[model samples]
Target: MHPLPAILIDGLRATLFRHPRVSATTVGAGMFVAVVVVYLFASILLEMAGTSPPWMLLPGGVLTVLGDSMLTLIAAWLLAVLAARREAVWGIATVLLAATVAAAVVVHWPLGELASYLVLHEHAGLAILVELVARCWWFFVLLVFAHWLAPRGLGHALGSAVLAYAVSAAAWWWLPQSPLVRTMPVVQATAEPTSGDQDGDAKTATEQDEADDDDAPGAKSEFDAEAAMYAQPALLDAALARLKPQTPGKVDLYVVAFAGDAQQDVFRNEAEYVETLFAQRFGAAGRTVVLENNAATVTTRPLASWTNLQRTLATIARTMDPAEDVLLLYFTTHGSDDHQLLVDLDPLPLNQIGPDDIADALKTTPAMRWKVIVVNACYSGGFVDALRDDSTMVMTSARADRTSFGCGADSDITYFGKAFLAEALNRTTSLREAFDLARTSVDAWETADQKDAKPDAKGVAGVEPIQHSEPQIATSASIEAKLAAWRRTLHESAAVPFAPAGEAMSRGASPSPDASTRSGKG
Candidate 1:
């Protein structure tokens, strides 16, 4: 056998509690170089072995191995201190380094893949069992290594092994998020037409999406934002053109829903839900325009922007009798402490909307008389002052000085979006009543989250906890009466059930709205 292979075989045997001929004096700086080479090979292999193809390789994956190496060195030093053998630290480090790599390749990738496959196949119970077994086996490997190296006792060796595993895990979990170290490459794969479709008659997935109905919630397709940005004007025009011309003498309702933050899918989900909810339940079919800043909808829906909002408001004013039709303006996104809506989609230069801009836009469009603007964002109460008027009703998610919860990648909808748009609005037509119910629901959720929140290591001892976001509302008697008259015109109907984009779009079985959203966390 080759010398390197022979050394690795001994190291693997040592991890399994088998004795080897390896000596403490023979382990030296050469072992460190071997460890580095092995780690690089293993990480590169793991990177290419993801469930999804075209996986981006993170170069800073080396940081993980470096962290593990340092932790192993520390553990060996601690064990040497306990055994009163300063000279034996290098030997212990050498063996433990090789054992850790063996554990990584044996336990992490192979067993982890089995557990993930079980999970993907909907065998979550089996997956959990496999994960538990994998963890036990990994710990056993480390414990065996420590027991052989520490002369003091099993107790001291156990502590050293625990420290090694804990520090290694912390490094693995947190280092990926470090912007300074990780340089992730974007993997874009190009595929040529196959022999069966050499004539180019087959449609690409994107072309198929465009050929399908945009109203279908399940017809989501991804596109390059920067390249497709020029299509925004035409997309907006097409959406507006689909609207049924306003019938004379009927108290019509026109909806302009804006989801301004593309970073969180929660905003996009909320916007999609609102579009379906208004069209199906609120008697606004062919009269709603949804502007979203999401990656999935960039090609299908008009990108949410300051310019688009102006065009939409102007077009709606021209379509409806400004004095008679009711307009509901819905805005969902992150807010700055200074009160600006975060309008963004990467590589697209979009401007953020402020309270003054909103007020000014509506102010210039003199024909939009009865207005109800809903702002679902942190620190949105600041908009109330600028938006309040006799003909406009302003509803905000949080106080000017406070923050709102439930807006992130994990959440399907914001706390306010779920309570107001999904639950309360479904049950009641009265805006005031819906706001009241939603406020109660939001308060309950925020309170529960507060109690469950754990103070992390970085938390200051005396710092005050985040307070409850008090949802604010400014109503107009005139607009309420107009809305009430429109409510009287609607045919009596059952409450529309809420669903997120995936589930709701799947069956297409409901007589009601099909956009379904998940619960909690923005």
Candidate 2:
């Protein structure tokens, strides 16, 4: 009834020449006849090649050919049906081949043996020979003649027959000998207990329990003690505290997670975990804002409308203090081409966020001091080109043209985010060291699946000390001061000359600044 099945039937009919080639009716009829005839001939040839005999030859060969023809027809019909249903063509072809081989093994071996016995003992070869001659020469030949007599010619039908023969031959050569080929079933019979199957029942129950445990959410918690410890609030607190200055007032932490689809639960979970880390590390005496997909209140506006994001950025720029000692921003979401961040909108386009938009947002907050932005998404390295400044440090999950994995719908978190946060919290590692470890972990995880996922950091240049009026107070020894010093050194090591507007515009080159010499004072 479907168009695909109709097309298939019409094609075969036209090829067969039941109707005239030029005439509409004969065109459809000819194709059907061609496919059927070709398939039959190919099946017969394959069976004859597989088995040959003098005593068992005639009748056994006839029956084998008949059975194989039927099986091939059924397989072809199944393939057509699947095509009609809009299934993948290649997958349907594979399944059809498998099914046909199974049916052939089941029907051929026993029938061949029986026919061989009949031919040897009772001389049934004469009847089989008569039937074969009648079918091939009379019936099949007549069918072809009738098709050719239609308004259309037999050329199309002959071509179709040739194609069918080629397909069948290929299938025959490639079909493997499976369990169905064996005359007897291969399943082993187990001894049944009479009202005393306690051990068996217990084993079955235990297996079921294990399967359930494996399927349960948070099941990994039972096995991964390190993940559990790393996720704890106390550990995060300790890690952040160890890095904080003794005279800390309020460190502003901003977390934003944009999961484009409801299917992207892994990104959502990673965002939540990261939020917990931020709260544990900076929440004691600092300001922390967690913006996730489901949260009632979010500082980062929903990207359902790009204008909302713009408004949110404007609000942050208006409210944020220019002299804030530290500002941390994290974003987890899908990414697009050329390393653009993808916002989850109703009709999501790939790589919706451009580098220009991010650059514009950063430009709005030019007065902020000691800014750190960590982006966990594919091709995130592009963000460096947009957000990198003398005072900003950027970490990205992967370079352009690479995919970051482990954020499937069912997965709780991505490999990059989980590894980065875990190592940062539990290993007492610097941000750079944590980024390196995260990259290694992500690489290993992706490698298992034959994928390459790597993370990179940029913007270790143009960093300088905050020029406050109280230089002595600002230069006091503290963990924050030590981290700033390290960042400054990294910036110095990676520094390049910063060309002004005219030269930069003419050259069309990226802005490069000596980070250690960069003045934090506006």
- State which candidate has the highest lDDT: 1
How would you encode candidate 1's per-residue C-alpha lDDT over 375-399 as one tens digit per residue? 9877789899988877789999989
The CA root-mean-square deviation of candidate 2, after full C-alpha superposition on the true structure, stands at 29.4
- Among all windows of 10 consecutive residues in model 1, the one with the lowest summed lDDT is 513-522
Best by TM-score: 1
**Where does candidate 2 have its weakest 10-residue lDDT segment?**
513-522
TM-score of the candidate numbered 2? 0.37
As a TM-score, model 1 comes out at: 0.54
Please give the lDDT score for candidate 2. 0.38
Q: Evaluate residue 185 in candidate 2 and report its C-alpha lDDT on the 0 to 100 scale.
A: 10
Candidate 1, which segments miss by more than 4 Å at Cα? 1-222, 364-366, 455-464, 509-522
Clashing pairs in 1: 406-522, 407-522, 499-515, 499-516, 499-517, 500-516, 500-517
Residues 1-522 of candidate 2 have per-residue lDDT tens digits of 543344444333332323212322222333434434443344444344432221112233334433444444444444334224323333222222322332233333334444434432333454355323322321222234233432244654344333433344334333321110101111112223212111111111113123222332322222233433233333223322223232334434333333432224454456545544544543322333333332211112132222333334333433444234445666766554344454432222212444554543443322344556776665566667667654566777766434455554355666677677755444532566666677677666554443231333663323222111110001112324434453442211211222222243366532211111000000
